[model samples]
Target: MTSSIGVAVIGAGMAGKAHAAAFRAASTVYSPVLPEIRLVAIGDVYAPLGQEAAKRFGFERHESDWKAIAAADDIDVVSVVVANSLHREIVEGLLAAGKHVLCEKPLSDTIEDARAMADAAREAEARGTVARIGFSYLRAPGIAFMRQLIDDGRIGDVFHFSAHYWTDYGCRPDVPISWRYQGPAGSGALGDVGSHLSYIAEHLCGGVQEVSGGRFHTSITERPKPIGQVVGHSRGNVSTEMSPVTNDDYATFNAKFERCVGSIEVSRVAAGHPNSLSIEVFGSKGAARWSQTNPSQVEVMLHDELGDLAGYRTVPLGPAHPHYAGGWAMDAPGVGIGQNDLFVHQARAFLEEVAGLPEAESLPRCKSFDDGVHNMEFLAAVAESAAQGGATVQVPANAAGTTNTVGTNTQEVAR
Candidate 1:
């Protein structure tokens, strides 16, 4: 017999829609050893958005206020997909209410808030509740395959990692600005898209110890103010006056990890790339590369072969991969996986973890809020280095103002 878990989502935008879809998909596609998820409610500040999301996503109820869902006794799990500014309040509230949470990335607008969220997660763990950060990119099958290769010592003695996440959405001068453009700090392209790359790097490489150098550039210092609501990359009519784009349009940094030196770069103004996150790792024995633009394959180079024959080779996604079974068949042609599919795999992992089934123990970790805080520290260090004229900045061994932070130990993840 199957059990049912009550789930709620707090947001109605792109990420919220994805979470809702994933919850529904988790029940149908992946055979997670968890109670089936029943999407209970979807909440947004806008009643129409919340109501429409409820109808479209098959939620049993709609709420114009997120606080309602947080207090709902029926909700066993909640996905906090709201703005970064709201993460701390909502996540802490939900956790304090004893609800499991899957928070969207960039855990909070400030390191202080992120630290608090992590602490709350630890507290939740003490109570047998789970708190996960959404680093959905890690759910990609090709990336998972690459991680396995690295763990198996196929890429022995990892020494280098280079990555960049670039998008053209903010390239045009007329692009309107919003809360995403203004923040306490480190909230620009670096915190927005770069955070994903940073976490994935730490996930694949190791903990970042310091940032040797950093630089930032804001090409469009000012942007049109939107006349109305703005969604993911959506353009809106603007008022006559323009607002300053205080955040970095692009950023680059050199990082020292526990076992490797890595390069990090991110831009919202890149001309051609859209959601293009490219990462490569080099080791004493071999190297591997994966790009999000073409999410289905990984390129690898093995130096163990003769120098004349050694070169990068592409490996396409198939049934043998981590998540192929969830959406694609062994015979599916040409990478049929969709971006939304990653969230499904992510949701499945989160639910399985909540179930505590012996089988769930092997799944790739649903990154905890602790990991989110760790990555936020790295991002904070990079921003500080840039602010200090590109000088090296040591990443704090512990999150400041808080004694709580997750250890940098490598937790086992399902392949």
Candidate 2:
């Protein structure tokens, strides 16, 4: 049977390509498990890139603008891969056009904007639309295993957790500057990367009750231009003229979750690492840590009071795992999955929903827009705290009146 929901993908850059591939991969990925992915149209401001991406990814057509795609009669779902600053305009347009939307992380450039987008999404849901943030790590097989472990009571009464994501490429003066360097460009270490860990904490533990944080702006605020012409993906074009860099290069936040206390560190100038992200959760019964550097394996450590010894473990991703479907289980344990694999899995989940199955039945449980907003709000608080010299701030009291009182989460930034 033909799939019911047609997909429209906006943007054609790194993440756009990944999302499109994931939508295509979702078909073969599920096999006997999920629904088909109908590629209605791929949208990009650059027509050639859009056409090329469509031809490469099996999209039925290409459009020069998202507005055109959003108006398509066949396009039922839209994936917004535009810049953070463009999220509000594009997403609001899609929602008004009666399309479900999947947007990339941190929601928007500002907390208020994020809240508005989230409110729009929530409003759309009442009319039967779904809005999701592209926090793809939540779909990783290893991360799914952690979720399962926590559900099985294997982790037991989660006590504490910590996560960190770092990369050193931006620190190099030779690297060309992009929107990532501008605070108004919807770019920064906190929103760009910390949102990943923030979503994870909110999902696995609970809403953050509060946080104390410090965000650092680097000394090298601008750089020299390269000797080449550039294309577009910016407010104007991806120019190489020497421009200013205005976002945080490093950030650290201390927080208290509903049942756990933790810290999150995000950076684009960590020195030598590239795309390093890891999360460690310690509970009363056991503890586990997984890294994005190695997407296929999860290390676990079980408590042993009687044996008088404790050690970590190595668990392999398998078919039994959430995101690791069929052929992937055949790969060697040491082999890994790429960043796009998470999107592939995420698309598969959406396909399942489109086919009339429920989200609970899909793999890689997708995050709702509300969930995304909660994380964004916490991030805003962190940014605020960080700006105020890592001031200790309390999370807004939960609506359910469930407050967690934890005391070990004080950090002085060690300045």
Top candidate when judged by TM-score against the true structure: 1
Q: Give lDDT tens digits, candidate 2, residues 165-194.
A: 997757676566666777842147777788
lDDT of 2 at 183: 80
TM-score of each: 0.90, 0.85
Give candidate 2 regions above 4 Å deviation: 1-3, 31-36, 184-187, 224-241, 305-310, 325-335, 397-415
Model 2 superposed RMSD (Cα): 7.0
Per-prediction backbone clash count: 2, 2
lDDT by residue (tens digit), candidate 1, 1-415: 2277899999988889999999988856544446767889998887888889999989999988777887887889999988899999999989999889999998899889998888888988999989988788877777777777777799899889999999988999888888778764468899999888887776676667789678888888898988888776777788878998888889999998766899989999998887888999999889999888778788999988787888998887776665565343332535566688889878877887787755434346577676788778888888898889889998765332221221211222222
In candidate 2, what residue range of length 10 has the lowest lDDT sum? 406-415
lDDT (C-alpha) at residue 340 in model 2: 75
Model 1: how far residue 378 lies from native, Å: 0.5
